[model samples]
Target: MEARMPDPVAGPITEKSDHPRTEGDPQEDGDTPRRVVLADPRSYCAGVERAIEIVERLLRDRPGPIYVRKQIVHNSHVVADLESRGAEFVDELDEVPTGSTVVFSAHGVSPAVRAAAEQRRLEVVDATCPLVTKVHAEARRFTARGDTVVLIGHADHEEVEGTLGEAPETTVLVETPQDVARLEVADPEKVSYLTQTTLAVDETREVIEALRARFPALRGPGSEDICYATTNRQDAVAAVAQEADVVLVVGSANSSNSVRLTELAQRLGTPAHLVDSARDIDPDWVVGARTVAVTAGASAPPWLVEEVIDALADLGPAIVSEHSVATEDVLFALPREVREV
Candidate 1:
């Protein structure tokens, strides 16, 4: 079957005007409608940018059938586009022919997985986000100090797996405050903590507090482990959710960061939905909503946001607005192989 591609780029859906609503000529009723608000820090993050760059460079320089260890990022559209361009995604190195070029996903990989790829002699390209790499380093540091490390993240995520591998025997995964309560340590005094870079900030805080209560001497990262991109996007969503009648998050269902955005909106007491693209938007939910907030996950492309806005425009004469909470300038460099090629 042919792979799917992202929606073709349409021109910018948002107008540059600062006005909340452009004058729509004098209405007979003498009332101007409110505009839809878009979150500024909504789209791709540095890690995601680097991941896509790796695939693009591979397609340009490498021959046919380059293997990727997992979804290049988390977006189906990105995976499909890369697959259409001759990239093959496999879950295991065993699936990749020996000596073939294979790129790792943005979510880092375990040492065992790396050893397996090395055993196969695959030409590997590491696309793990630098921020994730920092977490892996912290895990190793904690382990070296004879500390029982606690990892705050989803158990099965690729990034968590990789970080855990750095200190498997000592690392414990905690998803909630309850998990922290249930945790038993060989020595409470020697415990430290790290976390997945894309978790919900508020949820992670509660878990951290739980851990701190149990292990008074517990040390942690100088800053929160949740990445700036995740925090910023959530903050932007929350800013608009305060006023939006309904909120829509653009991303794949399996995407962790995307799911968090939807949950954040709902937690703020607003109805929110996660849609892979414009096609997933339900007209019924949006029909009566005077205001809607649209944001995208880190892996999601900005074009998807434009597509959703275009679809909303068809439903009614919509005015688009933007609310920017913060600016992000973080950038990650491509793997050496990709750069050299």
Candidate 2:
């Protein structure tokens, strides 16, 4: 069945009682069923797909030990898969044998890293998500205008790090509303803000509000920098969280967007767990949950999400359905280097 369009103005996100009777479901309870509701637009955003494809194509076309600077998008499964294909994951460009081909992760990289790769004369294939690159562009433009850029994102996040490196001397990082309060900018009147593309939308909004309150003249991106995938998945969770007794998010602990989905569900008063795969789904967590909401991080592969659904099935028979908040049609073109490949 087609999903109903999400109406944000709709009342509290509520769980429905239309559960299917699972095999092991103690017949003691009434006809309430045990089921899993899958969130649409859940995994492998355009950027992640492009990043992974870049490596796959590179592997097919090049004779390499193709080196990737980061996890290539933060999913353990993805990195492992690429590793099995002869892609070397490294923390630094120095690890690449000077002349070997190298790829930057989808998370983007600092200018210094790019310079390092160039200095080593390494053949580079950049797989930075176009949306993240947009944030970096904002940072450069704001700093060039003499505005002190206040980047609202986790301090250590790769996306944030790359954006900060755009104009480090002119950019400052703030993670929360409180950070805005304690921030001491050189000129409040000339301040601007940008954000990590995958941050939790609601939390980032609060931080933005805090920044504006402190500096009424604060500037921000002409259009918000949080990517469509992040907003869509977060909104998708909001639509189903109210109806789910419990929510299970599939992705690595370090996946910011995946973690935010868990946080979003929790904020709605539902118990949520962040799992790397089906292996982490604790049978104990779903003890009393009649309906479970399943979603995957933007960087996560669909296979992991499927594995989770299978794991949930072992708990009992489940009516798995897709709860789509919105349809996503965004696509980014491959980098020029591999466009022909």
Candidate 3:
């Protein structure tokens, strides 16, 4: 069945449930039908697919080790699969031999990193998501205008780091409303803000509101900084969370978007867990849960979600239904270097 469009006027974000499930045993529950509701927009957004395909094309067409800086898309499974195909994951450009071909991760790199790669004379295949690239451009643009750029995101995230590197002297990182209260700009009248593409939409809105209250003349990106995939997945998961007894998000812990989905569900008053795969699902989390909503982070592969559904079925007779907030038809073109490949 097709998914209905998300409620445009969905209620404001709610606080986490006061009564969270603490302890339980799946086996202890009496005979009950278990239904798994899968979030339709879950798994592999256009940018992630594009990033992985870039590496796959490089491995298939290029010779020697295809060095990739950082986890290609933040999923261990995707990185492992690419590694099995002979892709070398490196922490920095220095790790790659000079003149070797290297691909940057989907998270855009800092100008400093780009300078480092250029210094090493490495053949570069940039896989940074176009959406992230947009933020980087905004950071540079705002700073060039003499506006202090307040980046709303986790301080240590690769995406944030890269954007900060755009204008380190002028860009400051703020993760919450309180951070905005403590922020001191050289000229509050000349302040602008940009956000990490993978941040939670509702929470980011609050942070932006805080910034506005502090700097009434503040400016923002021409468009929303949060990518469409992040917003769609969050909407789908929030809808499913309303009906689900427990919510399971599939993705690595370090995946910001994936973590946001789990956090969104929890905020909507459902017990949620972030799982890398079926193996990570704790039985206690779903022991008494009659309806489990399953969702994968944008970086997670589709097969992993299927595996999780199968594992849940193994626990008992199960019926699965998909709760989609919207259908995603977004596609990004491959980088020019590997486009012909």
- The deviation in Å at residue 253 for candidate 2 is 0.6
lDDT per residue (tens digit) for residues 184-296 in model 3: 99998999999999999999999999999999999999989998889989988988899889999999999999999999999999999999999997777877678898899
lDDT of 2 at 109: 90
**TM-score list, all predictions:** 0.91, 0.92, 0.92
Clashing pairs in 2: 13-242, 14-243, 15-243, 19-33, 20-33, 22-317
Give the per-residue lDDT digits (tens) of candidate 2, residues 174-238: 99999999999898899999989988998999999999999999999888798888888888888
Worst 10 residues of 1 by lDDT: 1-10
Ranking, TM-score, top scorer first: 2, 3, 1
lDDT (Cα, 0-100) at 70 in candidate 1: 83
Candidate 1 lDDT over residue span 60-145, tens digit each: 88786789998879999999998888899999899999899899999999899999999999988898888898899899999999
Candidate with top TM-score is 2
The residue pairs that clash in candidate 1, if any, are none
